[model samples]
Target: MCGIVGAVSQKDIVPILIEGLKRLEYRGYDSCGVAVHQDGQLRRARSTSRVAELQDLAAQDGVAAGTGIAHTRWATHGAPAVHNAHPHFSHGPGVDAPQGPGRVALVHNGIIENHDELRAELKAHGYVFLSQTDTEVIAHLVDLLYQGDLLDAVQQAVARLKGAYAIAVFHRDEPHRVIGAREGSPLVLGVGRDEHAGAFFLASDAMALAGVTDQIVYLEEGDVVDLQLGRYWITARGEVTGRFQSVVREVRTVHAHSGAAELGPYRHYMQKEIFEQPVAIANTLDAVTGISPELFGDGAYRVFKDIDNVLILACGTSYYAGSTAKYWLESIAKIPTSVEIASEYRYRDSVPNPRTLVVTISQSGETADTLAALKHARSLGMLHTMTVCNVSTSAMVRECALSFITRAGAEIGVASTKAFTTQLVGLFLLTLALAQTRGHLTEEQEAEHLKALRHLPVAVQAVLALEPQVIAWSEEFARKENALFLGRGLHYPIALEGALKLKEISYIHAEAYPAGELKHGPLALVTAQMPVVTVAPNDALLEKLKSNMQEVRARGGELFVFADGDTRIESEPGLHVIRMPEHYGALSPILHVVPLQLLAYHTACARGTDVDKPRNLAKSVTVE
Candidate 1:
């Protein structure tokens, strides 16, 4: 995953490129670079440092070009170094000769799967490469194919390439234009006008162009775009191979203010988002006086009635949310449901049902694997697609037939907090809506569920008050090397998420199992040295979960339990218990997860780990 931003305007665009890169740093932050066309040549600055450092380097280098492209790279092909940073350059055919300046600068996101083959071919042509990045091959390929038109050269070069990419390239000779293309990765155009003249920008996401422009045009797959001062055109693959046709598309305005990455009065974004659960849940259900299929989108009722089953595709934290919803969709809605890891779902030779509703979950809504899985499902004749996402302008929302936007604003933490919980809220609402459509939910049942949903904010607030208790447990957990989490029924997925958080941020080895499966194998791993965390929600499976806890205690394993108020589990010797304020039925996972998040956050603090931006992780998986 990487970030790409390009600009073409009458004014100097170096600042715009740098600012946009700052907003996009969450997508990638391994290294950064910017290249601007100046003095009839390409002037560039690259650093194996943060965007702030790159900005300083650019200023020191005085890279004042009217047109430019910038990149924040997450190393995919090589180690993170200055040479591996983006804004890769390619000199013209006269690179070996002393001639006029002819150079091209390019920045790319996604992988070039066939770069080794292309690089060997380019090396035979006497091209010299300075970096070990696949992106460098693209610059040389475009340079060799340049026949006067930059857009045409990019189109031809990309056609011969393989694998996913969203790239932007600009030549020193053609300083007024930037050529961009997308195959499997995301790229968008921001259309704007200033006092002096019109401007156009290209970025991997809209957050990069927050205050720059609100109007955006999402480039489609296999699309090439030409961006010049005031105008841009998208070219799609035509009827025949290698043939292209230009088409016009509508520019949609988005709420740019909603995606602002502001950390207001909080030590870390994860903490801020954890505490914002109340507001995030309230805002996600805002204006929802009652739950109905129409709450998703227009004509959602028709799709709900027609679908016979549900198929959920997601990855990482989103996948756990889907698994948790599977319990709800089947038990409450009486609908058969299957949750599949997005990356693996498409590769398998499974049967696709047209009557099955495909539901995708993502926070950024730009997750590459999930998006590909959704497209694969659609191609297999499943047209009833829906998404639970945070960003309204994301491609997942645009591609789906119906969508429910989660009001979790700007989750900048690498380890997701609010986004995951809000997605659960949205998925739960979908389950109730489907149940009502299927006549499984009576009017009284609907009112009861709605009442619980309305009180969710208060429930979450109460759970957050247990942060001090979680912090106390974190001190002991910080010294532990291994942990095992246990839960049952709907809370099983919650146990998995808790384990994931602990390993993701604190770097503690952790595993989770449905409490019933502990005796099969995990019981052997329990010992005095290993701490066992249990999600003891006071539900139908509470007694069974308690038996699992006893199994752990029999092995001399210390127990840390977040149990509901009604649960009679007491804190005693070798048994640590923190009582949850209450057990909010059917929505207990949302409340139970808050303590787990705080535990991970505080344990990471105790262990001196970077909680907000975990090591070797990216916030959004935009590249597969």
Candidate 2:
């Protein structure tokens, strides 16, 4: 995934572009660049380093302009290098001419699937290629298609293209003008406020335009936008006609969490997010005074009654959240549930049921694979769709029939903490809603669940108070290269999430299995060097999980367990126990996961890894 930010303004926009890129740093990037129309010439600066380095380079090069496009590229078609960085230039048929500011400069996000064919076609027209990026082909294509109007050129260029992409382009001659388009990938238009009024911006995420603008228009699929000083217009590809038509997309006032992006009292965003879970969960549940199906949407009750089973589509951490929900949905709601990895679900042939409710989970809700899977499900006649997402204006929320917006705010950390926990809270509420609709929940049970949900903030705060204990355990875990996590029943997915968190941030190799399956295979990997992390909640399977812990101990494996205070799991030789404040029954996963997140965070800190921006990962998977 990559980050794109463009500005059309009366003031010098170099700083705004750099600041927007900085806000998007959490989206993960290897190379960054910015191009601007300056003094009747296209001036640009690029670096194969962080945005800060690119900012310095821009300052040193004195690259400043009121209209510009910038990008933080995560390598796709080419290796991470200065030549491969974005803001690609098209010199325009000057194959042998001296290097000069010629025509167009463009930045793109997502892959151009037919770039090779397009590149070959452009080469025949004497448009020399400079970089090994698909984005470069787009720039040269726009240059060749420029008949005068930059908007027309971009439209023609995109017409010849294939694959998912969001692009922003500005021509050398078209001053104070930027043209942006979105096919399958995400792009938004930010209308500036106060003193910055009359300025318009384009960004991949609303977070990129935070503080600069609160009014945002989420560009839909196959939409093109043209932005000038104080005006903008949009055109959308018609569904049946396959032709672009003028359309109006709703603009919503969103308060992007610019303050949340700041790491004030914490060392990293991951650490800050881990500590923000209590408030995040509380805010997510703030709208609910009592359990009701309407919590999802206006007609959720009818949809819930019509659905016979639940099909959850998601990827990565969100997928694991869905896996955890499968237990709650089936056991508590008496509904058959299936969790499918979004990338895999669309390719396989399977029987589809119209009565099945398709629920998609995503933190950013712009995840390309999940969005594609949602569309695939809709194509199969499963039109009853819902999304449990953080961003209210995300594509997932807009496409789904119903949505429950989480209050996790802006999760900057690549390894999710608050987002995952908040999603579980939302899924839990969904389970209760379905249970009530199915007549499996009584009024007393509903009140009980509601009370527990209300107290989640306090319960999570207790778990967070154990951060010191987790930090102590992190010292031992930092030295470990391999780990094994074990749990049973409802807690198994939490163990998997723990293992995922450990591997994601600490760069440690970790695996998780149900406690009952330990002797089946995973026990073979247990040794004195292997550290076993167990989620030992005081549930029905506690005794069985204790037996699994003993199997590890007998193999000389060191054990680190997060257990309930009443579980009576004491600390001993080769066995380290951290007692939880209370046994939270059904909500134990939310509490148990907090300490595991802390362990991963502190272990990454101990090993001096990039806890916020893990290598080879991005906060939002906007590309497949």
- Tens-place lDDT per residue, model 1, 1-624, is 589999988888899999988888766468999988898888889998788998899999898877899998887888999988988888754463312333888999888999999999988887888889999999999999998899989989999989889999998778789999998888998898554248899999888888888888989888899988877899988867658889787798865663447878888778888999999999998878897999899999999999999999999999999999999999999999999999999899999999999999999888989999999999999999999999998889989999999998888888888999999999999999999999999999999999999999999999999888889999999999999998899999999999999999999999999999999998999889999999998898888888988889889989999999899999999999999999888999999988999999999999999787677788888778
The parts of candidate 2 lying over 4 Å away from their true place are 95-99
Counting only residues 3 or more apart in sequence or on different chains, how many pairs clash (N, Cα, C under 3 Å) in candidate 2? 0
Clashing pairs in 2: none
lDDT of 1 at 64: 85
Instruction: List per-candidate RMSD values in Å.
Output: 1.9, 1.4
Q: What lDDT does the true structure give each of the candidates?
A: 0.90, 0.92
State the lDDT of candidate 2 residue by residue for 279-352, as single tens digits. Answer: 99999998888888999999999999999999999998899899999999999999999999999999999799
Residue 72: error of model 2 in Å?
0.9
The 10 consecutive residues of candidate 1 with the worst lDDT sum are 93-102
TM-score of predicted structure 1: 0.97
lDDT of 2 at 272: 90
